[model samples]
Target: MNNKTTISSFFWQIIKPYKWWYLVMIPGPFVTAAFVFGYNYAIKLLLDVLTQDKILHYGDFVYPVGIFLGSHFMVDIFFRISNYAEWKSQPQVRKDIMCKVYDYVMGHSYNFFQNNLSGSIISKIKSINDGYYYLFESIKHNLTAKFLISLLCAICLLCINSKIFIMVGLFTVGLVIVSMTLYRKLGVMQGEISNDYHGVIGLIADNITNIANVSLFASKKAESQSIINHQENISTPLRNKWFKLNFITEIIVTMIYSLFGISVLLYSIYLKNSGQITIGDIAFTMSMTFLFQDNIFGLFIEVKKFVNTWSDFKTSFSIMQIPQEKIDKTDATELKVSGGEVIFENINFGYENNNKVFTNLNLKIKAGQKIGIVGSSGAGKSTLVALLLKHFKADNGNMIIDNQSIYDVTSDSLRSQISLIPQDIVLFHRSVGENIGYAKKEANQAEIENAAKMASIHDFIETLPEKYNTLVGERGVKLSGGQRQRIAIARAILKNAPILILDEATSALDSETEQQIQKSISDMLETNKATVIAIAHRLSTIKHLDRIVVMENGAIAEDGMFDELLAKENSKFKALWDRQVNGMVL
Candidate 1:
């Protein structure tokens, strides 16, 4: 869409809901403009009376002064009403727009988050809110008010002399043309500058988030220099271009308006001296001319603001326009998982087209079965879990849980039936108990403690003075890797879903801790009778599972019990087992 249409539609959407408040505001500028016209007329009457040859009376003085004061009083009252209406509406408008933007961003698929920087996303959201708010405010207070007053002044001047009206009109038009050309150029520069700012923010966020890596590598100076270079490369030239254009535009506008004011004053004097108009007419013409010039100049400033705000609005709208990666089918149903039997039927999938990761792969797990998936790094191990979670749609075939095709169910409902304990655990910056309770928002203290105890992290938590209330810093950075893993396990246990997937769940723990946590997990699985799928690099971690599946390339190469697979010397599972055992021996 064109910029004008986009901005208009955006404001309409935000303001549509608050129609009543805007209605109250609509008459404010008109009333104020009328008062300005009336006040100038009152001044003209006083000037006529003063210049008349007849003896002046106190009554003549009282009439025009009273008219002027009355007009001023009405202007003051209407202006307050307008300001009040704006004050009432702006906060609500800002809140509603921000909430809509936030909801839209939250609904984007996992892939969007993975590909975009968190800091840039945040900056865009803030810019959208601030831009829209200020844009609307400027429209109300500056653009609308000034336009009305300028029109009223022009009409008043036209009554005095058509030539003067023509002069003022031409000057206003020239000023607008110049401003628009400058604004178009400035908008482009501003958009580029905004992108540079986003880049710098993203850079800082990335470095701070990975501060541990930076410190370990002792690259702080390098990172700082990189940030400085980015700023210099992106910001310096844009700012210089912006200032040069802006300065020239201002100088031109000032000169044009100043000359227009002088020409009008000189013309009004000539008309009076020629006996073609009275002194009262000259007073009216000059006053209207100055008012018109001021309002017209203010209009240029508002136009600049609109252009800049439009740039920000376009950036925000670009994010809102992103197509959702995953969408629910119209006929999708809420998944009702029972026993959690999972089947991958003739699946063909890949991250990119022409590079298949799983080609016509099929697998079935009976209800309540414990299966282990083993493969080297790119065997589509995590991809399988991702497919089951519906993070990505398969290229062909279906994933069925409890006889229901996953694609036929709502994602929220499908995901509600499963729990995952990922290898890299990241907890919210909240209380320890709160993080664990996130699995079930309504879970009570007893349930939280029970899950923590089951995950074998209860004792460590209890040792802290705050116990369950102890805060975990960002991404659980205050805790050790083992501690964070246990917290994740606890969260999964609390979720109590029908299907559980352990994606290298115990990889972070020491051997002793790993064994202890494994026993806890085993006990939970047995007690809950949940279907389990464990993916592991450490073969011993899942060797005790009821069944083992070895993957080679994009397809399954071996599937059998742990001992059964190990007995086949030529099997992929046996090869992986020998490699791990021999590496330990070395």
Candidate 2:
């Protein structure tokens, strides 16, 4: 997460912090393999003592018994020592990885979140953490210990008989070649499955998020069938590729083991007939063969797990490759808000694949001035606010605040000077006080209470069981539209920035409450000489504003005071005002 690492190198980059612990862990596997050899030798010694033609001595029994108990005790001690470091490091590393990945996701542009599913992003982050768990386990139980066991067992066999060791070595090579080839294919298949898995998570999230709509439309069965279809699509490939390949690999491994067992037994018996090795040597070889074979089986299972983990990790890591949409210029400076005079010069903008919404559009609002913008839907009202907030850069134009081009200033600094009350206000699932205080983190209770009073929501809030401490629920679902809008207003009022923009700020309130809020907003603005740009669909909400600008399509059609615009026959504002007065549908 800290370094610029490729997917393949990220594991080691994270592991580097705990290098000393891993170094200490290396000897644990060696001791485990050594224990296997020691225990096999004990078995051989015990068999030799029991089968001896001459009377067995008590000393021989003592030697075998001591070897068995000592090997077990030694391995247990070595395991506990190595495992302590491993347990200390792996879980912490996973927690760090999840936190870093989540932080990286947070830094992504707004468009990225809109384009991707939240659930899918969460799933990917989980995969990265789980993959690390698999990697550490594989290193411990699969690769190091198993390889050492195989090597040590081969050496033991070599000491017993060169011919048997040669056969075991060749079998090891063949089995590895076969496993590697199949594992490579499995890796590719697993990558495909990982993608499908992410998609399913996203689809399920989408369905659940819109559960209200599904219930309203009474499409329960339809939605269930949709999920079933997706499951079927995923399961077919999973069964065909994932399950089938694993079964084939298992079958091949089983066949190889059977053949090796038969060959070793026949060779050992022929050697016994020729008096080349004792019964104890044969016992040692057979016992070692079973031990080594079990480890190989475990190794293959872990290797498959590792391959799937690597595939998931690669899929999840690809997210970091997406370039962040908004990046501050290296030479950008902070925005110093001496006065909040805003100017839009020769602006050109349009949504992708849509006709131009603004061409050479221009507007200017002086400091300490309050102006209302009135327009029908698709009249570039919200787009103007978006450009002001730097949500989307215009195709061509310069937006200047206090004579500083917004692009020349750092985005964070630029936005800090302007407070916007958006049309669709989404509140966090938290206490109302926390949501209001979000605009100003250091704001105390007195300041938060004052802002809520100014927004005209304090009285209603007092009626709740928890008052300001009441949970808002997800996206403020527990609140009415009017309540949510007032919450947004409170947040903006608390911000108290030099520049303020309100888009449909009072649309959800009733006419009486709207007028009260209009007065409250005016009183609040009068104390602070800040610039205000208000966009309104309900024209009366902004009728008391100092000036009105009427928009048609992508350009301004009329500009004047509210009464002045109404007096003119050709004015767009007058037409809109007339329509509203007549209670006409807009």
Q: On residues 283-339, what C-alpha lDDT tens digit does candidate 1 reach at each position?
A: 888889999998889888888878877875676567776766655687999999879
What's each prediction's TM-score? Answer: 0.94, 0.91
Error of 1 at 572 (Å): 1.5
RMSD of each: 2.5, 2.8
Model 2 per-residue lDDT tens digits across residues 253-277: 8888778778888888899999998
Candidate 1 clash pair list = none
Model 1, residue 197: C-alpha shift (Å): 2.6
What's model 1's overall lDDT? 0.86
Give the runs in model 1 whose Cα sits over 4 Å from its true position.
Answer: 1-10
Most accurate candidate by TM-score: 1
